[model samples]
Target chain A: MNKPKPDLSVRIGGLVMQNPVMTASGTFGYGPEFARLMDLNRLGAIVVKGISLKPTQGNPTPRLVEVPGGLLNAIGLQNPGFDGFVRDYLPFLRHYRAPVIVNIWGHTINEYASIAERFNDLPGVHGLELNISCPNIKHGGIAFGTDPKMARRVITAVRARTRLPLITKLSPNVTVIAEFARIAEACGSDAVSLINSFPAMAIDIEARRPILANITGGLTGPAIHTIALKMVWETARAVKIPVIGMGGITSAREALAFIIAGASAVAVGTANFSEPLSTLAVIKGIEAYLVRHRLPSIRALVGTLETGAVIPKPRGPGRPCA
Target chain B: MLIENTIILSHRLLKGGYRLLTLKSKRIAPMVRPGQFVHLRLPSPADAVLRRPFSVFRAQAGRLAILYKTVGKGTQAMATLCAGDEINILGPLGQGFPNVRKDTLPLLVAGGYGMAALYLVAQRAPVKGIVFVGGAGADDILCADDFRRLDWDVRVATEDGSAGKKGLVTRILDAWLNKELHGRQPEFFACGPNGLLKAICKRVGRGGWDGWISMDRHMGCGLGACLACVQKVCKRDAAGRETWAWARVCTEGPVFACRDIVWD
Candidate 1:
């Protein structure tokens, strides 16, 4: 007798995915770029790079620097604005079955709302991933993601503009990630995704300057997986809205870790650069894991972490130092 | 593009720290075009996380070759690989050089290992023109013998006066264009460090010669997803209005028109 397959489908707010494996924005350039290397239809969802109100030229050369277990990138959210994306890329992406998630950013709250409203009537776009935490940009990105008030204001304004599933991507640069996650859920954001690359910088000693032309970039890959895992776990516990986990997801083991830590879905970021089929491989590996453990569905494994110890919460803001 | 683990058929050390590593891949050779490159995953012990990008120096029957210099940690690790070893590769990536008319003369320029990309162009060239190559010394003039065999006129310049003329390669090209070309304009092609490409852009812009230059940059995904390797280009819109945009070097081109490039 043939065994039945495990249920891999997952739901992120209104967006239904065939599986819980998605390609992170910026890493997976608007879908068509990786189409020749792998089948785009097989992905859980394709989150394109951040699109602005107008076309952006991005930073100058030497935009990337590879470290031991990760990459530092200051690509500056370079994308074909809202109109350019719809005209040039959306048509090709419409051919694929995967849900198209448009990751967007802007210099102002009005700009973010405007871009979101524009994609509302667009045929192929399934959701909007608000990129308020991109470390590479000069303004609006990390600034909004770090402030709870700004995060609330931006999500609230954009929520009124579009009925599309709103995903507020949180920043690790914040002091309390759970607080921000709660703010998004309170503001009517359908779901929240997080751990947009940590704000980082690499220096060239001889040149006495930064490695990236943008001076600083977002640090991502396996190097930051553990940190992301902790943040995702805390954020998931704080909100009822689903949390899409991402940051240094390279393999099924890592993706599985995020699921167990409470992420509804996982996005493969920097890994796509090294291996184009990493998402597919992770999907297969997760299925194999499910079958091996006799798990009936992917939902059965979500937030299944069993921490044996119960540490007492810290009391009072400031106690006498010993 | 296909990804496969290929066996190293041979590795030869050339002058000036350059090495030619040939891989035995029956699947890749037939698909290779001029200006296309292969992304090589080197066997590094530490810190060299990304796969190195190398231009297709030469591709022949059931084999492909990459010419690289040992300038840093990644190349240093690549230099140690011996024949019979296996290395992972993704290729014939990016758009290659555009086809030229058989009747037009083609002038080729290269500096150091930049010569690697032009040999294939020179090989399939219909009308051969002069080859200008500049290096630090005599040994740095790579693949000159290969061009001589192809019956293309080769000119050499070295900074140390170890070879033909002493000075920059752009000087040699300028002098030749003045003395030989006169009123006749030839198609130009170049690949090298940014400085070399910038020089060609200036000369080509002033002379109004039609040609392209291959660009090099630190790339993450050689398939254009990463947007890490972008070149500023003067693009034309549907209304024929000129606009400056950052184009992907991996997809739009490693080869771009000389005039299209927005040189600094």
Candidate 2:
């Protein structure tokens, strides 16, 4: 009478991930780069670096800076472009068991839809992650993601182009993240991933200039994990579409924080730089925690936060009357 | 690419704050090439989150060595490590130097600890060539004695004129290329500071010598995933218009052809 394994499989949009741990885009390269280091099939999904319609060289050198608890990068979404990725990278990626979620971006709304339409015909790609909120790029990155109308327009346009599941990666720079999340859901988005790296910069005083060549870069790591959790909690309550939470998730405990806060799944970002096998370790840890808690499935933990509905008035402290 | 716990065979203090660390890594040593590097995950978890990338200085029978200067907190902590300590490492990563013809003369130039990556390249150099070692003073020129021991020609240059020739090593190279090697254009190989690399790349591009340079950058993941270490690369369009694009220093190259790199 052996106990059955805790069900780790979870579905986001239409893509059913074997586990809830996926590698965030930009952290994981096209695929073959990390395949030798870790078993790619074990991952829930592989989100590669953001792709554009044309090959982009990205930013200048000295694009990275190390802060207290994180890293800042202005990589400018450098990629091999859409056609190059399909020809050079896609064939090697097709061999892996993991589903490939192409993270695509563009400078204009028309560009976003056109890119989405191209990926729609690609054979190996399972889903599309719309990177409408990258802070590192100067053009339409955070532009469309921050504004509600712009987010709606881009999501609606992309939704019309591709039949694949769409996940809108939202920016934390917005005043209210839930508003954008709601807009995505209303505009027919299949899912939403929150808290892309926050805008940050480091200074080299002796050099008398910013540490990053781009002057400012997106900050990602443990420093932003707590903020992501808060945003995930709010966005989950706002939209019916599954919420994928990520920001400095290095371990299973930190990832579980998102699950408890109502994230259908979690993506490992900056931690991948420190430990290539971190995402696999996180998957194992999540399953172990479920088994330890006697939970049958990961869904049981989603949105289980107890907000203390009935607050008892302060009774004895300082003898204050209510 | 193997990640294993490697035992430090020896940690000797070299001149100019450099430490010649020898490690017994059976898994890594055999695969390492001239310009490849190993990512060392320091033991201190609280301080060093990002693993430091050190170019493979020398590799031999079941052992590899890295010649590193203690500059930042990561290298400073690396200095405190002694022999018999096991350190975690991931390597022989990035593309190594391109193979050169056995008959071609190999001219090697290095600055500071950047010499660490060039020693292995020089060992395999054919015919006859000169090794240009430069530093702030004589103490900064690493592996000069090692190269000479191999019966290779060695030339030294110090900024303060405390060693062989005064001024920068690139200046010495310029003088040699213009004056002595008038007819023979030796294949150039260099590893040094960005300014030094820039000067060398410019010279090689203009001088018409086959040249390769090993670059150094602040990297997050020594592997290609992080996209942290980027350099501008020169590319030509259909119209032959020169254009520049970002190239990952960790993946596309730690070593690149002179024409491939666009000097700023």
Candidate 3:
């Protein structure tokens, strides 16, 4: 007489998420910044702002600029050190029902391992989102993420240090992103999240200078959505491990596309800045999609995109032939 | 903080291309404190992914108002909003100006539309003192009468000699400190451009008096999550050693003490 509730649970390595929706790091801050606005427990996981080995001060002022469909931010990975996060944020986050994925970054391979090692015995942390891909930072962030050999070294070093689920957040700047994903798999990374914001710039024509103090910042939001989707599709096919898709997801439609393309999960980044209730909305939308399509569970939707057999439909007059 | 689909009660253009937007937000209006702001998602600028933050000019009953100029794409888009249109707003955000101390005289300083942020500060002050406002010209000055209606002494200054005093607001303030001073300690609440705020900060530092400044920066997320609007402020440890730290302007401030700011 009744239909069953669609099962939305997803897992990234050992961490089990109630749904596939996650709050991207940097955009979500720590778990508490948004807790007052939205339920922290509702998200699949809360991927907090990146943390480093030592306390980082970030960049100078004029750190953000809004473009047509997105924004460019040069926040420069400003964050509390590993100890600072453990002491100030961990206890508060441990109380949330959703898993806490700490985004960790460093200036060197050793720093990456050291940061990972500190979180090993931490009671609250469910996983580490290795942020080798932040484009804003001058040093470790942009460097380690773009270089293939270095990406392997950093992932390997961090994998050796922490027993927690390791996620290598890959950069979109690379020519072939799948090669890096395969490297992460080889290095023992449990999952991979792609793509981080694209390296971008905005200029003030009147001032004749870059709008951001850092000149170049990472671009995120609707503009990068399609590009990120392609990268997710590529990386998903490249690795057997879970692929967490992110970049410009503002609603469930984009999240669904990610899942259909092959993402095991989706992370809401810039959308969190615009709408704090977006994660809840995305989760609800995904469930509605599942019910509408009569899919038994979210797992069934993963990599369900049909390919290689479809013909194109013709548009109205004056359009090129399909 | 709340995100509400507030309906526009009225939208009118005042002197100098400024738009005074009134919204019926039973959920958020009553929660507003002086100097707090609302981030509006403009209807036009469909490509815009960020919400623009505006200072609360007035909040009462089940309605709130923000007085802003058509400065950028976002505000220009806001000009297209009319009565009964729904607008998404996240509000009563950031810390507002603190209460005027009992023993201190409350002096309100503003620059142009900055006066909008200080109205409640003036109305709520236990004692009414002098209000000094400045702008580039008469067209740039706004809301001087609103303060006058509140029975507070209002002083005006324009750089082009088109208004009250023929120089900066600080010049008139200096004159008051010299002639009107019978040894009354004044606590200052100011909102203006960075230059005007820095000038007020200099005076606050010299007089050893308290001054609160509302800073306006390019904000990405009005909620402190984005780390887009950050101001460096001096922090002290248990040992009293001072270190400068980046405090989010969208959360820790929009209002910060003049003394704590470490200007770049």
Count the clashes in each prediction.
0, 0, 0
Which residue pairs show collisions in model 3? Answer: none
lDDT of 3 by residue, B54-169 (tens): 99999999999889899888888889989999999998899999988779989999999999999999888888888999998998788888899989999999999999999999
**Mind giving the per-residue lDDT tens digits that candidate 3 earns over A195-265?**
99999999999999999999999999999999999999878877789999998898899999999999999
RMSD of each: 3.6, 5.3, 5.4
lDDT ranking of the models? 3, 1, 2
Residues B1-264 of candidate 2 have per-residue lDDT tens digits of 988899999999978788999999998999988899999888864534588899998899999999988887778888999899999899989988876567677888899888889888877655557888899998898788888876778888999999999998988888888788868757888899988888888888787878899998889887887777877798787799998767778888899998899777
**Each model's DockQ?**
0.73, 0.65, 0.79
Segments in model 3 whose C-alpha atoms lie over 4 Å from true places: A310-322, B237-239
Tell me candidate 3's TM-score on chain B. Answer: 0.97
Could you tell me the lDDT of residue A206 within candidate 2? 96
Model 3: lDDT equals 0.90
TM per candidate = 0.95, 0.93, 0.97
Which candidate's TM-score is highest?
Answer: 3
Q: Evaluated with lDDT, which candidate comes out highest?
A: 3
Report lDDT (Cα) of residue B159, candidate 1.
88
Model 3 chain A scores worst on lDDT over the 10 consecutive residues at: A313-322
- Pick by DockQ: which candidate is best? 3
